[model samples]
Each structure stands twice: as structure tokens, then as C-alpha cells.
Target: MHIKQATPALKAVAALLLTAALSSCGQSQNAGMPAAGPASVGVITLQPQDTVITRELPARISAFTVAEIRPQVGGIIQKRLFTEGSNVKAGQVLYQINPDTYQAAYQTAQASLAKAEATLTSADLKAKRYSQLVEIKAISSQDNDDARAALLQARADVATAKAAVETARINLAYTRITAPVSGRIGKSSVTAGALVTANQTTALATVQQLSTAYVDMTQSSTDLLRLRRDFAKGALQNQSGKAKVKLILEDGSEYAQPGELEFSDITVDSGTGMVTLRATFANPTGELLPGMFVRARLEQGVRHNALLVPQPAVSRNQKGEAVVMVVDRDNKVHARTIKTSQTIGDKWLVDGGLQGGERIVVEGLMKVQDGATVKPEPLKSNASAAK
Candidate 1:
């Protein structure tokens, strides 16, 4: 019986020793795992210089000056002097009206003016002789007064004739239809034989000043208010008050010259809830035409001390907030929530949650979990990451 009890005690001691040995082995394996350190994230250094924030806006081309040419005098179109769809300068003759009748009227007025001047000279001589005779009692005072009145009447007649001559001259000059503005002229509405009236509703042609063009765009009032607030808070600045604009044509080709903002509508449109904005660009080549659809990018403001990060480094949490994996000094990975504002270029602008010089994960994020120990490795360039 004593031998049987010793055998059972020895078995119990062996079992305890085996259990402790297994536990020690497990602890040793855990200790051999490498501790996590700074992750190999694609990082861009924070910049303090001015960075422009641009907004792509849809717009249309417009003319700075447009006019509908009309006739100023009533007459038949004698000749069409210019080719249709040609550039015209101000005061350039465009059409010629028959001036035979107007010329005759002018000559008649000039003859009447000459006759009246002769009558005035004779009346003046008669009035002077009559005045001398009245002083010598050789003529009556009433007769002398009549002679003076005749001279004044002749002078009045000459003045009337002169006015008539001026009127005729103006009518004669009106026979030539000239361009009131310098621009590109459209096709003529009336041909050489067609009769046109003074101030007619139908235009003779259309002229549009395309040397300098206008680009019309719209912006929401809410956006403008937000931008203004940010500007007042020193968060944004229009380093270029009239920031340069870039045009994207319908065919996707960029315009050669840059434009500048010219005007912004004061009142907002109640129907669309947007305010109209205009930009001016020099179109020396006439490539940009009126009513052409276009896309314009306007630089709103520049941000100083901006932090931009790669989009892959940012992830969404359960709350739908953006989060990034940061490696702490203790060589452990920790998930951090960040606040983001807008996007500049291809990266996101981080408003909060990241300090400079902190390493975030750009790769191997799926292989590890929170607080997991890892061996940090350099990120290899791949097609999935930003170029």
C-alpha cells in the first residue's frame, strides 16, 4: 500500500512540472515577437507658403461690347460697301445712300443765303442815307425808322437761310452710313436696293467687340458668404485679388491666355439662388467667341501653412469620420481621428489630428490591427499609390 501511494505522488509531481514547462514556452514565444514602430507612410512635408485653392466653375463666353447697327437717315441703300462678317473700325463707311435730292436742297439753300446777303447790304446803305437825310430834315423820322426795320428784316432772312443750309448739309452727310463702333460686323439685313427708314426696328447689321471678351459665371451666395468669413478670419487671402483664370474649352483644350475677374453681380438671382460673375480676357486672336460654352477655374485664395496628405493614408471609422493610423513613440500603432477641410491638388487638406513629423501608415494597414506588434518596413512603389 505505501508503494502504491509513492507512485501516485510521483505522477502528480510530473503532471505539475509538465504544465509549468508549457506555460514557460508560450511566454518565450510571445517575447520573441517584434514591437511595432513608426509606420512607413507616404508623407509630404507641411508647407508654409501660399497655396491657391481653386474652384472649377461652369461659364459662357460673352462680348464686352455688342451693337445692332441701324440707319440714322431715311433712304434707299445705294451700295453695300463692306463684305459681310468682316472687321470694321469706328467711323468706317458701311453703306451709301442716294444723295442727289439732298445735294439739290443744299445748293438751293446756299443760293437763297447769297441772295439774302445782297439784300441786307442794299438795305444797310439805304438805312444810312435815310438816317443822314432825317438829321438834315430832308426825310421824315418815320421813313428813316422804316429803312432801319428793312435792314433788320434782311438780316433775319439771311439767318433763316443759313439755318436751312445747315439742315440740308446734315441730311446730305447722312446719306453715308458709317460704323458707330469698332467690331466684327455681321451680314447686312438690307441689300443695296432695299429701302430703310430712320430708326427702323430691323437692324442693318450686328457688331460685336471681340478683341477683349467677357466670361460670365455664377456662384452660390452661401459659398460666397463662407469664403468671405474665412477671409475675415485670416484663414484665407486673395494674394491675387483678381486671380488669374484658366479656360477649359468644350473640346478640352486649354486656352492660351489667362483671364482676370472683372465684376460680380450684387443681387442674387431668386430663381437660381446664384450670383453672376464676369471675367475679362484679351482675345487678340478671336479664338473665343460669344455664347460659347466653357469651363473656368478661379483661384479663390491662398492658404499659408497648409498640411496636405495622401488620400490612402486616410481611412473612415465607424462614425464615418476620417481616421489615420499613427505610430506612437512606444512603438505601437494607434488609430487617430482627423478633421479635413478641402482638397488642394491631389491631396487632402488636414485641418486637425496630425502634427508635423508624425509617421502614418501608407502600406500594410490591412495586415495589422490596433495595438498589434509589427516589424516596420519601407513602403515599395506600386501602381495603387500616387505617382
Candidate 2:
């Protein structure tokens, strides 16, 4: 090799080049290596839980008892004993019809009864005399028989007079129209001086018992059948001995008192294909009125082992099917199509497509795609968030 003398400036330049080459090689190695681990996702572990499912159905408030006040005896209304739109008790006089005619009729019946009694007394004395005469042979047999028949006829007349008196008394009582039930009374259809007929088609007034009211709720026959089937299959349990119901007023405020499901009609409404269900609620304040629209929250049954998934974790795909992202044992994400029937609080009541013990992505869903590898991090439960 030839020995060449190099300058100090050239030697410094060579060192700089070598340093640059090493830096470039290190940068290339870093670029070829993996950037980071799989994306971390917040997930919830699926677990079977007991859930109480309730349905909200439209309902109408009805009075426990309804009475239409009608006149039993025809007469001119003399006075209205009760104030319109006020509470009245059973047997409280609501209207007073003219009793003058009834009183006269009653007096006439009494006079007739007195006359019959006088005749009966005379007939009894004559019959006794006839019996004695027939035994002593003092009177003819034909005369005694005639006397006995007259006595018997007199007794029948007395009985008939007594019945007439009773009828008159009943008619006099009917002059006053009283409430049949204790309840709030509506406006009077007939005022003072209005003539009313016996058993008139038009009512004088109406009274509705409101201390306790009924809520008539209609449910689809299909849904009712499904509930029955579920209960029969033991899929649902009646945790409460009786079904409990809550009322939502028309203004959207919940009624303070809860009610119990009374009974469901056996026959379905042919026109609507619905079953009529009734619930009884206390209306001490008279807040609930008849014909008022409301909603009833009815708890039909409880499911012991139900799979619930957070609502946020569920999404609808292009096909409008409900889907959830679940992590497999290999840490791979999969989009699962699920069947959801209803919402239990903030969770979707999953009917199918998920088994217990699967890790479902609840948060950080935007960062991961289906079939993507992910590192699942256990997320805090939000069970109470719905409430």
C-alpha cells in the first residue's frame, strides 16, 4: 500500500461522514420495527343477572262504581237536595219530587184498609152466628154456606187493602231520589219544577265513586299470550305474589300511590284484538278522575337469568339489526348480531347472540374495528347510571 499524507481538514470530514452513516442505519432499523401493541379497549364482561321487566301501556281512569240517578215515581221535581258537582253519601237525598199526590193516595189506601177491617169484623160475627144456627138447626143450610162465603170474601178484601197500603207507602218513598253509592256527584239534568217520569231514560244526575279508582288498560293479545307462555315455561318468575302497577298521569307526573293488578278479562275484544286489564288505585285526593288518560307501568314478571348489555355498547348495523362488539379468547374483536326485545334500565335485554363470560366493548369502540386485535381493559359497571 502507498503511504499517502492526508490533511487534518480531510480527516475531520471523513469522521463526520462515518457518524452520519451510523445515524442513518439506526433510523432505518427503528422504522422497520413494530410501532406499538394492539389498541386497548374498555370492555364489560357479560354476566347473567336478575331483571324485572315492565311494560308501559296506555290506560284510562274509571270510577269504581257509577250510578245514574233516575226517578222511580213520576212527579214534578220540587227541589234539588244536593249541590251539583259535590260529594254525596249513599242514601243522601239528591232530588225531591212532589209528594202531595203520593200522600193523598196513601191516605185513600188507609181509608180503604179501615173500611175493609170494619167489614171483616162484621163478616166474622155473621159467620160465627151462621155456624151456631147450623148446629142448632135454627137456619137453613144454604143460608149458612152463603154467610161463610161472604166472610171469606171479606178477609180477601182486607188482605188486598193491606197490599194497596204498602204500595202507596213505597210510592211515597220513591218521591225522594237518593244516591245509591257514596261518591262525587255530577251536574243535575233536571232542575226544580221539571216533571220526570218513572224509570226515565234520562238521568237526574250521576254519581261516581272516586275514593278508589280503576285503571282500564288494554294490552295486545299477542303480548299477553307471550307473557303467559314465558311464565308457563318457567322463564319468568312472579317475585311478587301480585302484579304491581304504577300510574303516569297525563301531565307526565307519576302517581304517588301504586296499585295492584286486579284481573284480566278472559275474552279478547274482537274488534281490537286486545285484552282488558284492570288495576285499582287509591284516589283519596280525587286527583284521578273518570275518563282521564294515563299510562300504567305494569310489572308482568321477573327474569332470573337474563343477559343484559349496556345500551352504549349496542349499535345498529346497515341492515338495522342490533349488533355488539365482543372480544374472543384470542383478543380479536367480532361484531355479533343480537336479538333485543326490550330495555331494562340502561341495558338492552339480550334475547340471543351472546353467552355469559364474553367480554364486550363498551368504551373505546371508535378506536377498534371488527376482526381487529385489541387489548381488553375491564371497565367499571354502569348499572345504576340508567336510574
Candidate 3:
């Protein structure tokens, strides 16, 4: 019985020793193996290229020409000859006031003019006869002088009568109100038989030329100064022959036709501190209406060598400073602060804080920390990825 117990204890000790030796071997094997390598990140190499810069500004649509139709003379409106919201030609009759009174006045002035002319004829004949009589000593020199003065008075009276007739004719024409400009007419404020006054404050109708439209945009004085400085420094070039502009409607639809920058105000607005810019666009389809809100995309200038980085590669810190992760030659991650001027598509135009040939991390930013080792991978082009 003693031998049997001793054999069982020996077997247990041998099994425990084997388990310890295996555990030690496994620990040595793990220790000898190297740790995992650094994490891999996608990066893009920065390059300088010529780029065109455009600025989008809020703008307001205005008519090329606006005219308010008002009565030149007071009278009862006899008829409204135009349909509301219709295109009208210049000098097109729009309204017909009661012309009965004007016509009668014109006729009366005409009769007065005829009577004055008849009197002048008689005066001229009498003056000539008196001159002949004076020469023959049949009439006194005083009589001839009196006849000549009468003729001059008759001529003056005829001139006054002619002016009255012309005035009456002009008044009669005013009764037929006509469009002063060729454009689209708005709603009429008066109807037939409606009483109107001369030079009334209220307009009978409005006409706006819509064939071509004006887009009035504003830019801050500071920005204008900056742009001028850049131009003076030769940092930007206007490759486009003229200042070209494009429009975006209130509904976010782009206008089919482009526009030209007509002019910019020389003086800044005191109230807003902005300079007004006007662009003219063709509106053959009449899509752009007066007072419509729009946005104008104007090509400001071209930068010869501009550095741009993908927007996704840049991140803002607690202080709201733009920062990016750059992989150095040693494959070490670095946090670099950058100043971005504007966004162009999916990229940001870098104004400072970066140089050419630097590797900017675009992917796997969360996996790596600053100053840590990273495995750099070239970012695939979007076109290649799409394929």
C-alpha cells in the first residue's frame, strides 16, 4: 500500500513540471517575436498649380430701364387700351382719356387763329395803302405810322393765337397716354372713366425692359482693397479678357447665359461700406425679373502658383485653427497649422503654412497620433476610384 501511494504522488509531480516547462517556452516565443508595425494612412503630396479663383456674391436683379407712366394732363380716363402685364412698344397707345374737352379747346383756338390771321391781312393791306397815300401827300405821315403800328400789333396777336393752338394740340395728344419705353407693362392703376390729374403721384402703369437685365452686387471695401493689393503685387492675373460673371437664381438654378461686369461704383456706400458692382446679362427668355434675388459667381483673378489641399485632410482644433496631419520623410506624423483662403470644390486654397512636396494625410487620421510612426500610402485619385 505505501508503494502504490508513492507512485501516484510521483505521477502528479511529473505532470505539473511538464505544464510549467510548456508555459515557459510559450512566453519565450512571444517575447522573441517583434511588436506590430505602425498604422497605415493615406496621404497626398502637395503640388503648386495655376488656378482660377471665383467669388460668389449675393446680388439683386434690376431692370435695364424702368419707366413709370403718369398722366401729363388731368382728365377722365376714357379707355385703357393695353392689357395688364403685356409687352409694349415705345409710343404704343396705353390709355385714352376723355378727349372731348381738349378737342373743343383746340377747335376754339384754331378759330381764334383764323380770325387773327384775317385781321393781320386787313392790317397789312391798310398799312401798304397808307404808305402809298403818304408818299403821294394824300394822307398824313402820322396816319402811315399808325397803320404800321396796327400791323405790328396784329402780327403779335397772330403769334399768340398760334402758340395757343399748339398748346391745345399738345393737350389733346396727352389725352392719349402712350408708352414712353419699349418694355413689359405692369398692371394699370386706372380704368376707363377714372379721374386722373396732371403729374399725379400715383403711376398709371410701369414698364420694365426685360430683354436684358442688370444684376447689382455688393462687395466689402476691405475685400476690394485686398484684391487691388494682390493685383498690384502681381500675385494674380486676369487671364479672362473681361470680368465675366455667371448667375444663380433664387431657386438655386444657374442662369443659362453668362454676364459681363459693366462697372463698379467708385465711391463706397457710407451706410453699408460696400462698393456696388453691376453686371449685365441677356434675358431673351425673360427668366430674370426685376427685384429677384440672385447670386453672382465672378471670376476675380488667376493665381500663377497656388497650393490647394483636400478639405477632408484639414481639421479644426479646440481653438478653431485649421490643422492637418503631415507625414515627414522619417514617416513620423506631424500636426501642421494652415491658413485657408477659400474653398474650391472639395479642396481648400491654402494661403500659408504649407510647402510643395509635403505629404498631407487624408485618410486614417484617427488611427495615428502626433509624433507617432505611420506607414504612408499614396491616396488614389478620385477618377481611378470611380472606375
Candidate 4:
């Protein structure tokens, strides 16, 4: 019985060995065990770019010119000369006070002026007559002297009357209120028949010159200090030395126009440690308004001849430093640590750890390790394959 069992076991073992040998042979040829070469990978050719670094900051829209209109003379508004919310030019009549009152005063001034002129003429004639009388002794010396004194008094009274006329004319002219600036007028604070006071606490109306608007932004002092430090170290490049700024509205849409950095506050706020910046934009269409919130992009600097790589190619290592896989001329892949400033479009502005003309492993980063050999196809071809 033992010999019979052993014979069957041996047959089973031999069959198992034959099956293993056949499987090995098939795998070696068809299963890609020996004949297959290294797999192809996607890569990007490192190139230099004139990259600009910028900071996006929150901003608020402000009117370039703001005016609070108040009456200069206390009177009832007789007529609203300007339509509410209409554009007005400088010196344009905005409101007409009861011109009847002013006209009457003006006419009174004219009468006073005529009376003063008549008095002046009488004084001149009397003075000439007195001089002739004194020279010819046709009248007593005291009488001539008294006539001269009377003429002098009349001249002084005429001068005083003329001044009163001028004062009355000026007061009459102040009855009509006009716009001091060219701008879009706001709602009428005082309607027709409403009583308005001169330089009163209540404004007659508000006018905002929106032809050119201002976007006021603020940046942290820390960011400014960092930029200054980087500039000092020559790690960053600033085109035009100072950066140009642009705006994005609150709706996340970029403004149709661009703006320049007009001013940066020299003093930083003690509480917020922020420095204010202002950008001016032409708003001829009046699309921008005062107190509208928006975003401003301040172009802090530019990086000349920068080695750019896709953001996907960059990974953070254990120490939190950015690293990318680059293939050398021999197609040997190596992990290079890089210091990046910021992103421009789809790539990062590399500040260090990369030279121009290296093949950066953009797509096949996961497939290759440090010092691994790769067959790098053109990055464009790999991108197309992905799509």
C-alpha cells in the first residue's frame, strides 16, 4: 500500500514541475519579462521667461474728486436748474434762488451807484468853485474854506455809497448757486421751495468727479519688507524699478483697463502694519463708483531669464522645500530642490536650483525616482496624449 501511494505522489510532483516550466517560458516571451525596454515618459523642456511677480491685494474704489455742495447764501430754492443725477460743468447754475429778490437788490445797487455819481459830480463842481472864489477873493476866506470842507465831506459820503453798492451787488450775485466742479451731481438734498442756509451743516447736494477713479489698496508691511530684502539681495528683478498695478472688480472679473501705481504711503499703520497704495484708472464711462470693493494686483517685480516649470512638476519634500525632477542630457532623472517665488500663469518663477535647458519631468514624475533613467518624449507630445 505504501509503494502504491508513493508512486502516485511522484507522478503528481512531476506534473507540477512540467506545468511550472511551461508557465515560466510563456512569461519570459509573452508576459514582458525580458524583452521589453524602459517605458516612455512625458517631460517638459526648461526654458527662460521674462516672468513678472505680483501681489493681489484688496482695494476700494474712491472718487478722484469729491465735492459737497452747500449754499453760499440763505434763501429758498426757486428753481432746480440742473436735473437730478445729471452731469454738470463747472460754473453751471445748479439752483436758482428767487431772482426777484436779487434783481430788486441789484436794481437798488444801480440806483445807489447813480446817486453816488451825482453826489461826486456835485462835490467836484463845488470844490472848483471854492478854489476860484479863494483865489479871486470874491468870497470870504472862511466861506471858501467851509465850501471846500463841505465838498470833501460830500466826496467821502459818495465813496461810502459806492462801497455800499458794490456790497449789494455781491450779495445779489450770491443768490444763484452754481457748481464749483465738473462732475455728476447726486440727488438734490433741497428741492425747489426748500429753505437752504449758507454754509449750513446740511449739504445742498454732493458731486463726485468720476471721469477718473481711484483704487486704494493696502499691503502688509511684512510683504513690503520681504520685497525690499529680496531686492537688496538681488534675488528678484523689478521692471521699471517700481511695479505697475491693475484692478479686478468685486465680481472676480478683471477690469477692462490697467492702472499704474500712483502712490504708496510712507508710513505704516501701527495697528494693522499695512501701507496704503493707490492706483488711478480712467473711468470715463462711470462704471466705477466710490466705495466699491475690488481687488488690485500690484506688480511687485520682474524676474528676467527665469527658469519656468509647471506647478505640477514641483512637490514639497519632508522639509517643506519645493523639489522637481529634472532629466539631464544623458536622460538620467534627478530630484532637484528649488526655491520658487510665485506662480505666473501655469508655471512657477524659480529663484534657485534650476538652470536653463534642462528637461523637467512634468508628467512622469511619479514613475521615476531620483537618479532613475528615463526615455523622455517631448512634453508637448505627452500633453497631447493626456488630452
Ranking by TM-score: 3, 2, 4, 1
**lDDT-superior candidate, 3 or 4:** 3
Estimate, for each residue in 277-361, the C-alpha lDDT of model 1 and write its tens digit. 8999999999999999999988888877766667877789989998877776665678889998766556677889887666666
Per-residue alpha-carbon lDDT of candidate 2 for residues 126-179, written as tens digits (9 for 90 to 100): 999999999999999999999999999999999999999999999999998899
In candidate 3, how many Å is residue 11 off? 19
Higher-lDDT candidate of 1 and 2: 2
Q: Over the full model, what C-alpha lDDT does candidate 2 score relative to the true structure?
A: 0.92
For candidate 3, lDDT tens digit of each residue in 56-114?
Answer: 99999999999999999999998899999999999999999899999999999999999
> Rank order by lDDT, top first?
3, 2, 1, 4
Query: What TM-score number comes out for model 3?
Result: 0.88
The TM-score between candidate 1 and the true structure equals 0.74
Q: Which ten residues in a row have the lowest lDDT in candidate 4?
A: 378-387
Kindly report which residue stretches of model 2 are placed more than 4 angstroms away from their true locations once superposed: 1-40, 382-387
* Clash pairs (backbone) in predicted model 4: none
For candidate 3, the per-residue lDDT at 46 reads 82
